[model samples]
Target: MPLKLQSTFPALSLFGVLATLLSLPGLFGCQFPPKIDHGRYTKLFSIFSTEYKYECDSGYTLVGEEKISCSDSVWSPAAPQCKALCRTPEIANGKLSVYKIHYIEPETVTVQCNTGYGVVGSERITCLENRTWYPEVPKCERKILAGCEQVLAGKHLMQCLPGSQDVKLALEVYKLSLEIDVLELERNKEKAFQEP
Candidate 1:
């Protein structure tokens, strides 16, 4: 009887352990992981509390809030509005050229030329949604007519003589005087030659 009781005891213990395990919900029925509530900003697993943020695409400007929130499982305040970026005047050879511009939108690249240089074509440009800008870059050129006044100043006296004195009469008088001097020298030379 003792030997039989010992064998039966082992079997009974095994049966009890199996019965306890089988009775659990995981064993008897399908057990699932806990479900998260998406209601009223509740439990957004991958996101943070209330606020969500998004960045605008290149060449686009954000017109509304950069951040949005979730409430009752729905996005709050809607997605931010986007607009096409405005342009700004461009500059070329900034070291030598000059330009002026106003930026109409954000993220627009503005360039300018240095002073004493002028630009050609449209100076203002903008980056578009297509990732491009219009009007391209302008060229820079040096300013013309640097020392014209100095040249004029040098010729001022020459011009004043024409107005003050009769040019034709003065020229004739000067020629006659030269002729007289030449005749005198020739006469002297002839007299010397004849005497010798």
Candidate 2:
């Protein structure tokens, strides 16, 4: 009978290296390395040779290579920056639901237009992996009201305006009150005639 030797050794491939580093994850650093804003380099992992790497923080991604080389105490190709996946853009006459200053990759946000305004584009946008927001932010446009000003402010108008419901509601209440007064007057008149 021939004895077989099973290889229990783990692979040191890119994923294996990363997985090993992930086990001890918290923060990373490199000796005498270039400073990258919103970014950090992973621990030195050895295969054929030891190396330094880079990764970005939450809501940011590297713009250049993740692996950097140090020669003669100088970093080659420069250190990549951790760019924001998406910046909270200002929506004129509208508002975004996200309260964060910046958003991470794959995050989506919903936009809402103020009263008396209509949206001109998609109401939602997603943060793409390419460090950009998919589909530009939507714009809010004030609807044209041909006779909005002409309509009395005390009643419902054809043009959609803020507080229009309140105005129409008040008008309805006023009409009902007048109707009650007329009915009461008529009842009094009939009673007076009968008394005479």
Candidate 3:
């Protein structure tokens, strides 16, 4: 009986060691998927039925599945791809002054209003990671000169002078009204600049 017990003890130890070795791979989460370029996994070691979150690089948007799971020794939903997109935004009543024609991610462009117009929003816009412009596109609006219409209307109330003098006086009034309008426009612009 003592001899039989000694023989069974060694066999039981060997069986226990074999069982631990066989289960180590699954227990320690050693199985991992392949490395992805421009992407990252949620965990270093991917275990069976483990779901991993993937992220793409800046300026590149994810085109396929965002999360993938490891099942049956294979990555489900396959691998996602990072796609590059260059989108140019349209500015209303203005045009974009870009260094390059193609507007890729992180690219910046200046918005300039047309003549006789002023910008109401941001002067510059940046391309975001999602292939869209940040802060949206700015718009240009027509600038109104303060008291310009009133000055023009006051011209009709003035007394009429004689012959050529009347024509000269009218021209002079028109010129003075134009100057006033220009000065008022400048003052308004300066006020806008000082505020904010």
Candidate 4:
């Protein structure tokens, strides 16, 4: 009996075998695993304290944390949340612009009045590590002017009345005359001490 010989696998035959093996999955009666829909799995995954990233809806903002990671295929207890952050207070007239932190934690803003007004506390106070304002709430009050009695001998005299103005003017004139007399006396003494 003559022995039948088998053909050796060549370059073309190797390629054909590979193609058949790869196509066999789709050709034969085989089924792939069901794909997981992210939306449907979202609620199921939320039960676990797994770190996740969630997008906020329009018109709504996200605060606190935005992203987190899961370890051991489980979310951490410190899950990131989306909260509303406090907005910066409206700046009043003659007030400086304080930093408005929408993403960060709440902060306090202190306003300082112009030079004419007296600032009750710090001009610009902000929240410290404790989330509390340094100076709390500050106020601005108008500076008080000195009264007539508080004025010095010839300082800041208002000309409210003509009679009072005349008296103030006379006092000023007498003070000027006294200064002139003193200067004259000093000159006379200096001349007397000078050599001939």
Best by TM-score: 2
lDDT of 1 by residue, 78-162 (tens): 6665555544433445631222242324244444556766766555556554435565656676554674554455456356565
Clashing pairs in 2: none
lDDT of 3 by residue, 1-196 (tens): 6999999999999988866554443443436544566667564343233566777776566667878665555677887776545566666677888645457556778899998799887888887656777777788997768856665454554445557777677778878977997999999999999999
Per lDDT, the best of the predicted structures is 2
Residues forming the 10-long window of minimal summed lDDT in candidate 2: 1-10
Runs off by more than 4 Å, candidate 2: 1-41, 44-54, 57-84, 145-196
Q: What digit string (tens of lDDT, one per residue) describes model 4 on residues 152-178?
A: 434444434368768778678857877
For candidate 1, the per-residue lDDT at 10 reads 85
Q: All candidates' lDDT scores?
A: 0.51, 0.70, 0.69, 0.49
After superposition, the stretches of candidate 4 with alpha carbons farther than 4 Å from their true spots are: 1-69, 73-78, 81-84, 90-93, 97-103, 106-110, 121-136, 145-196
- Candidate 2 shows a clash count of 0
- C-alpha RMSD for every candidate: 21.6, 15.2, 15.3, 18.0
Put down candidate 2 lDDT per residue, 64-183, tens digits, no spaces.
Answer: 878866544456667787777778878899998876777876789998899988889899998876667778888998875775542344344424445768667766876686689799
What are the clashing pairs of model 1?
Answer: 40-72, 89-124, 91-111, 97-113, 97-114
Model 4: lDDT to the true structure: 0.49
TM-score of 1: 0.32
Q: Which model, 1 or 2, shows the larger TM-score?
A: 2
Clashes per candidate, residues 3 or more apart or on different chains = 5, 0, 0, 3
